[model samples]
Target: ECISSVSLSSLIAEEFDDFPDAELILKPISDGGDGFLDVCRFHFSGKILNYQISTPYDNSELICPVLYNIDSKTIYIESADLLGLKVVSAEFRNPLKLSSKGLGELLLKIENDVSSGKININKIIVGIGGTATIDMGIGACSALGLKLFDVNDKEILAIPENFNKVEDIEWDNKTFPFRIDLIIDVDNPLLGRTGAATVFGQQKGASESDIVILENGFNNIRNFLQNKDITDSSNPTFGAGGGIPSLLYLLLNAKIRRAKDFILNDLGIGRLKGKVDFVITGEGAFDHQSLMGKGAGIILQEFEKRSSKIFLLCGIIRNEVNKKLPDNIFPIEINSFFQNKDESILNIESGIRLACIKIKNNL
Candidate 1:
């Protein structure tokens, strides 16, 4: 349904309203992706501050929400709001042309706000997922004073298309005013068969030919950095968000934490009272990837031992992954209840309601 976890949890609770005898423990979690800011707002007392920033394509501006917690002196940012795949139109989903200038703009805004005494914060938590660009964070670094030059000493734009032309690089001398923490779910490395360009390029509108170019583009940057005596970023999590987090880690010393650990630290599994009768969780597509440190996987891991039964209601469920699930875990593909794909999407609410009814009948 493309809705927030808070909204989905509320909807599920309403569907099971007739079962008043049972207690509903709604714990909405985020694996540092689309609903990161919403999860923060749900768990913490904060005010949503809107800031105008450039979009991924940089052809327009977007107003993105930043969760500011004055008491905690922390700010939360969801990368999806700035450069997510969902934000870019299908026709304009070319990673070669996209720029993460908006993410840089947002960071600069926070820096300026802190320096001017407009806001006091000690930490910035960024959810680096769902990005559309794979420019090795060059677009973002450019906004922070990075400069790229060609062999002829001509300036080069910070985009994948120009990566091959880049011969020299310059970094921003300014240091960030606060600590930066990046939360990521995937474990792929920055460059390789399992890396960003190869694994995620197609989803970002990259063709087979485009993926080859993108891989070379990433290699150009790595070679440049290696020549400068910089340690290569081979960390698995560095691959998340089109290698954006990897660049941020090298350039800004941002700390990277797995989404599962981050969520567990914030909401421990032990906090839930009594034995849980049923655990209901969902995502857009439940597949092998979902088990790879995604929110749904974390939910399943934590509640499997505590709950009597777990309901995995997803829009589309891959049978291969479903077959590997535990006996007590029930996977319901919402589309099975509808006539067609379009009908399923249109009646998503009803599909979920019907799924809940089936669960109720079993109880």
Candidate 2:
């Protein structure tokens, strides 16, 4: 079993100390964003190339890379750099005025690097979560030259405090060298109760008043884009970083589908049916979000269809996955395993190995 992040690593140490004879071995699991790109290199015969882009918080610049598999005609980008909250401190974690410009820059860089490959950017599943900035998609559009200007025709750079005053939007992206498939993790609407403003705004540090401003902001941008014939599943950046999905749909013609479906179908998870005794997966949390549409939930559903045993391990699991959950699905939260923060996060490798070990032993 493999884990990711420091917390999982520490947990494994504790496990080793507790049960010296445990048969399982734990390694780290990282997406392309961190060390996983290197793991990818070690496991597969792909070349890792580097490019510089500002970190998500805009505090400094760093060189991150996209992995290319010449034989597969595919490129891999680790969005954790931009999406992960590690770059932002608690103060800046406030989504109000948080910018996703780094993400846009990263995407543009990938597009530039793939010039010689001649293969279209078919699949782009951004590991979305832990984002600090929530300019909806404004920061990203600005980085890509999709200008949103005020009535005076002066450039409106920062995310407007509220959407009520958005005057106009301009975009001329008729041609791009490649196509993109965006894998998203949520189903938040563009406005109102279930939308980004109502649900995620507060956690992002928006007050009640700020929520009003953000709601209006998202609506204004949604209107602006609609006028220009750029719209998406929700017509704005609703989910993943405040309307990032809608922005991708309009500007990039990307689809905002569940990440699990994309990964499973493309990776041929069905082909692996009955190949393994049990399956385990998870995310930051297991909640209503997982049941509606999540990579983990979808994977479990797929396994259910195949009559395979499925287990979920999460940092935290909601009392209910959904109002009506299937009988076969089982969720285990390893948070109960640790007595303190240091212990919980000690062996933390994103909790995958621990989750896996628990699942294995239980089965």
Candidate 3:
């Protein structure tokens, strides 16, 4: 699923080839992560609005896609398109310097377009995940007209590196004119050991010292919010997208929902519960973390509730963490056939097809 769109498509094609007479239903899912927009595009009829936006590094440009659904008057935006770690080079990846400003710019452009009658969007659903920054939404808030000032009454950029310098933050509610819904996969809070920077900063290329700074930055922002009477910083979805949902919840009154639940409800999965034979769900990797509120894990839970057999096809299976898989669940790992991660990903289609063939012949 991470390598190419062909992985899922190839899986479906092979599944149909294996069971020509059986009815096959493909429900591609994402945990509001990297592939979220693709899932939305496949299921929803929408027009894509492309705009030149800043990359996470703040030095380059990316043509970000926003899906505007005509039927629901909703606009779908994926944060990864703007601030994804993949957008930045591995050598230069640094959470301290990266910003979510591109996200803000996209939102502002959407709002302006709506205000000018260019689009009739009333709802904004932002898929927040797979981001590169740990600024706690400061870069995004700045783009939405939130001003941060230092002790000397000088304006400052709200990046993680400058977190300790921010003395005050200000914003105008009238700037944003749409109902915001944040789609999140994880339920970690905004503060503490399991919080944004502490849990995810290292993956975004933050060093040990950088993580300490990032933690302090998040704490500073938390303290600032506390002084403003926004004391509830322990919300479950706050840690998602580098605590972007937390800021959106505090400032924009955004509603939070698990991406799997939201997508399942939207796809009317409840109606298909008993009609389906078996459910096949997966992601790039399967591990203990996936069970902790991730989309694939949630899908597995749903299928289990319906008493359906489940097959998990993943690139890698962390046996140490995923040792307690359910009795009715079967896990297929493609790592055994390849020598390395890159090779495994490049040959994912063949690996999955082979796995399907074995399963079909065995059954």
Runs with alpha carbons beyond 4 Å of true place in candidate 1: 268-270, 273-275
Model with the higher lDDT, candidate 2 or 3 = 3
Looking at candidate 1, the ten consecutive residues that score lowest on lDDT are: 266-275
Candidate 2 ranges beyond 4 A from true positions: 1-45, 57-59, 114-125, 231-238, 305-308, 321-330, 340-342, 347-362
- Alpha carbon lDDT of residue 283, candidate 1? 90
lDDT of 2 at 304: 68
| Every model: Cα RMSD to truth | 1.7, 5.1, 1.9
TM-score of 1: 0.95
Residue 356 shift from truth in candidate 2, angstroms: 6.6
How would you encode candidate 1's per-residue C-alpha lDDT over 304-326 as one tens digit per residue? 87778889988888989988999
| Candidate 3 stretches greater than 4 Å from native | 4-10
lDDT of each: 0.85, 0.60, 0.79
Indicate the TM-score of model 3.
0.94
Error of 1 at 235 (Å): 1.0
Worst lDDT window (10 residues) for model 3?
A: 1-10
